[model samples]
Target: MTAPAPAIPATGPTPRPPDTGARRKVGAGLLDPRQLLRALPGALRKLNPVTLARNPVMFVTEIGAALTTGLAVADPSVFGWLITGWLWLTVVFANLAEAVAESRGRAQADSLRRTRRQTTARRLTGWEPGAEPSAYLEQDVAAAELRRGDLVAVAAGELVPGDGDVIEGVAAVDESAITGESAPVIRESGGDRSAVTGGTRVLSDRVVVRITQEPGESFLDRMIALVEGAGRQKTPNELALNLLLVMMTFVFLVAVVTLQPMAVFSRDFMAAAHDTAALNADGVRGIVLVSLLVCLIPTTIGGLLSAIGIAGMDRLVQRNVLAMSGRAVEAAGDVNTLLLDKTGTITYGNRQAAGLLPVGGTDTRDLARAALLASLADETPEGRSIAAYTRREHGAGDGEPGRDVARPGMTWLPFTATTRMSGADLPGGLRLRKGAASAVAAWAVQNGGTVPAGFDYAVTEVSASGGTPLAVARQDGDGPAQVLGVVHLKDVVKPGLRERFGELRRMGIRTVMITGDNPVTAKAIAEEAGVDDFLAEATPEDKLALIRKEQAGGHLVAMTGDGTNDAPALAQADVGVAMNTGTSAAKEAGNMVDLDSDPTKIIEIVEIGKQLLITRGALTAFSIANDIAKYFAILPAMFGAVYPSLRAANVMGLHSPASAILSAVVFNAVIIVVLIPLALRGVRYRPSSADALLTRNLWIYGVGGLVLPFLAIKCIDVALVQFVPGI
Candidate 1:
């Protein structure tokens, strides 16, 4: 067997300059502390026991605050009250983190709402026939009141009233209001690209839109809900981590409770020597105990867990990839293999006609006649190109095929991507067929036809030159089908596909190009595009079997499709991204739709998914690690006052116990505010093998998480002692 094809060279994502030219409506001001301060009361409102009880980590702080407040009220020392007050703010800080995330989304929602004002929709009442033909008459109504299934007319410069499918006319739509891309998109009636959003504007011409969704249920509403964090739910991983933090909090509680008794026992044992370092029953202040528990738990991550998940979804929307669920987004990160087809995906979707070839010493005109008649009713670009090429080359008449040649009761076969062929039957018992070389040859032999002398040579020649060869055949009632000729279709591999396939390889994902084209054509395109594997002449069954086989090995698979035949395979894959310009069956079967209709967009979705998972993991690692330093800062200060020897755990060597606890509390609070940008933007991702990424992240986030907090806590301690009045 010949050696496998070498992989294509891959590279980075399509580079885009900062969106300053068409800036996003949301800005850095969303993170302003002054804004957070203004939203504090609302943030605090969410900290009610009923709401806080849902979070295992923050609930511990909430309970700690209640106990500490009682102790501070009873204690005579002003120092005790100061520490107690700051500890309560610690709980508020966590609430503030969640509130800030919600507030940012709300600001963007305001901007979205401004574009969604109540507009007058032109509802079609009926039409009147005149000398110019039927003219449509419409009545004006509020866009918001327009129910689903209502027909509305939108002229140029008017906003689309609701999410709907275009039923009439073609126009260029400006989607920049929602997508942030200034380029206008062309939406036409019939065939895909008909989904018009409510907030977008029709730049030119007019369209009659049949509303498919109700006003509040439109895509814009879903986007607003997404940004406002209304859809955020606790992921399984987050719930598991929260449970672990709760268990750890219990362990710390037992330790803090037992330490007081241990200290009293030490004093009893050292009574003869009169050791003043021994802790007594009262040596452990209740306020200090509350402080220690609040400090030790994973509050930073716990506070921002929902915010992180919400941010991940927001980032996806900004990229123009609409995810149906957060779970689906998470699943994208785990895909091991991607299944894509050649036409419209690896190659730019123009499959054009280069020329025609006649076989069996037949007249070229006869072959052209058969190819054109077989394809006249075929609407696919390939079929149209064949008919057009024949007309251009052989001077065929401009009459319709059914109206001119093959008359009544003739059955027409539509081209299926699975069968890779199409043909027509005549009531007079004549038949014309065209399809992939092998498929047509098989069909001919099944009907008792023998292969023509140069059939294989013709196919081999076209396939060798990277052209799709469709074999044409003709037959009568009881006679064998004879070969007529070949149709040469040429399509180019898209630019940047080489780099995208290469990037998937580096990211530890195997990309396989599956196509209905012949094996030779498949191999040629696969080699040029640089995919890891290629499946040629793949039937729908073959595509499905391939996915099941890979999944049997415990590998997660992602696939893209746009045809009715592709729906089952798409549903079978782990992450299915369908083209918005594809058939409705394809969109219904997949979990996501790419409005831009780019086939290689599967790579972008995978990257976004991976980035979301990595971002959450990194922040979680940091949140857990920072707790180690908090323990170091709080535990020693709590015990140091009674047992001077226990002060050794104070690695930072702060000014006093009061100042040390204050600094740790402040640091814990401030860190949540500090990470909001990262939560929204997500962590940076670099394409590499999984093992390499793991090692790199372990060192960067894991180790850095362990050490960064120590230094941060120490810096805050030094600064607070110099400037803050209480500390």
Candidate 2:
């Protein structure tokens, strides 16, 4: 190849010791006690009808608190004042639930912004490979003020100021601030790894970046906005739940308002049979009316609904995976098939020359010499690995096999998918080729060379064992070529892949492997990894076609990719998780990008998505179920004095009208505090079928929600009347 570019000194900026990997993403989740304490005042302040009106359930409580306050002030009684104060606490508790959820996203945004601070950029008038320190002027600018198309040189340990494409040089970038993984990944000019995010830190070498986006318009900025809820809109499920809550509120309002007249009718009907002589005033009926509406209207879920959605997106950010929308996170929960590539994703991707096998009269050293010459200028990973192997194993230097090593006017033929081979042509009319075994064998036989009887056997043996066989050939002038030998390229399957795929299968996701390798190699890898299926010799077009076919059948497909060829498929898939170590195009195309570059991280993502939905569904069941117990505790207490027959329905045996109402309200408020940890941490997930998970959650939240409240209300009422020395 052309002479290697001169190496430059890495003296631009020194990285902080701890900043090499992702800075620790430590922050308060919604459940932290300190976070709760900080949010209490804002939650309490939002208890007014103006702040609470959007939530129909909490707004009813506000109205009840206002009316009760007036009654407590006008005609003071221990029960009237006590009921009024508890009604106020009811509104505050609902506000606290939402505040805690918003806090998580805000905390993540703060952490991201810290990594995006303004740094000195070496401003360049024009980029040149050999530009010196004097050719570029160092200038300081705020990261937010950076404009698109600005060319800046970023050295080792410097933060990238804007999202851009690397126009020159190569370096490793630490992207942990955005993707929670701590590893520093290589970014170079040309090919897929050229794009650089604005907030990531450069760890080594210097790159001249051509800014592709303005300061606030970068991917990281948009992600920060998403986390902070600046673009917050209710999710589809949340909107549906809201509509349902409004309908439920309307039904409860009609039932509660008309019940007063029904209670009056009950009073007259039971006037002779019950203790109607002792009961007086409709004030108790009014207070109990508001309490029943607040409890029946799904208040617990409505209060924490927005927080649940925000926390899901926030959880993704904390894990170093950024989702373009909250909906994508939800879709991940429903992914049915996972299409992953064999290289880099399933295997380590470092295909190496394990051994060289000479054929016919060819010597082992001669085979290695041919491999080294063929791969001398080759840039592909497989080529570089072969060159290194020849140097280490055969003691070959940086030249052709024999003496007079440097050949004049030698040209390298790069390997292409169409040609299926690469080699060097020397000025002395010497030709060397190495690539797929089949292509090399055909060329040798075409040039009148006799093939060894074991040639086919050698190729078959290598393919069967999963080792890629690259056959080497040589030619002199216009004469026939001779087949030299075969290079055994061994690619390692990543450790623990089989177990992870098993976990995905347990989660009801079918894992499929797609690769450019032959069917024999693909089959070997598929068996070792335990994937449900595999597609061999898969081109980029094949990848796109498979995604479309799966989507046609209504399967939610998720895949990890790192190449520009993968962009279309990633865009087409339901849940496209691009590896951060992949190209910028892949990152931009996919809905989510994994910072850690771990393919199995999709499992964690799927778990987080499922947990979010489960948390919402469980709390909803709990909220509606709680209304059942509220009616039992308060309805009879409201009309029990006038209609003694209704008193039997008071299974709580509450000591007073105020105590029963107060106890139900107390349980409603405290339950929000009790489930805060569950809301933030999310419900635990079990790898069972959808039907089984639904059945289990329903029992925990549905039946338990109904049963637990009745017992809790009774206990609170007993404690209040017996220990507090009040009515």
Best by lDDT: 2
TM-score for candidate 1: 0.71
* Residue 427 C-alpha lDDT in model 2: 84
Q: Estimate each model's TM-score.
A: 0.71, 0.79
- Compose the digit string of candidate 1's lDDT tens values, residues 671-720: 88788667766777777787887778778878988898888888888886
After superposition, the stretches of candidate 1 with alpha carbons farther than 4 Å from their true spots are 1-45, 76-78, 120-159, 168-171, 202-208, 254-284, 351-459, 469-489, 535-552, 561-572, 580-589, 640-648, 654-656, 717-727
Clashes found in each candidate (C-alpha, N, C closer than 3 A): 2, 1
Q: Residue 290 of model 1: what lDDT?
A: 69
lDDT assessment of candidate 1: 0.74
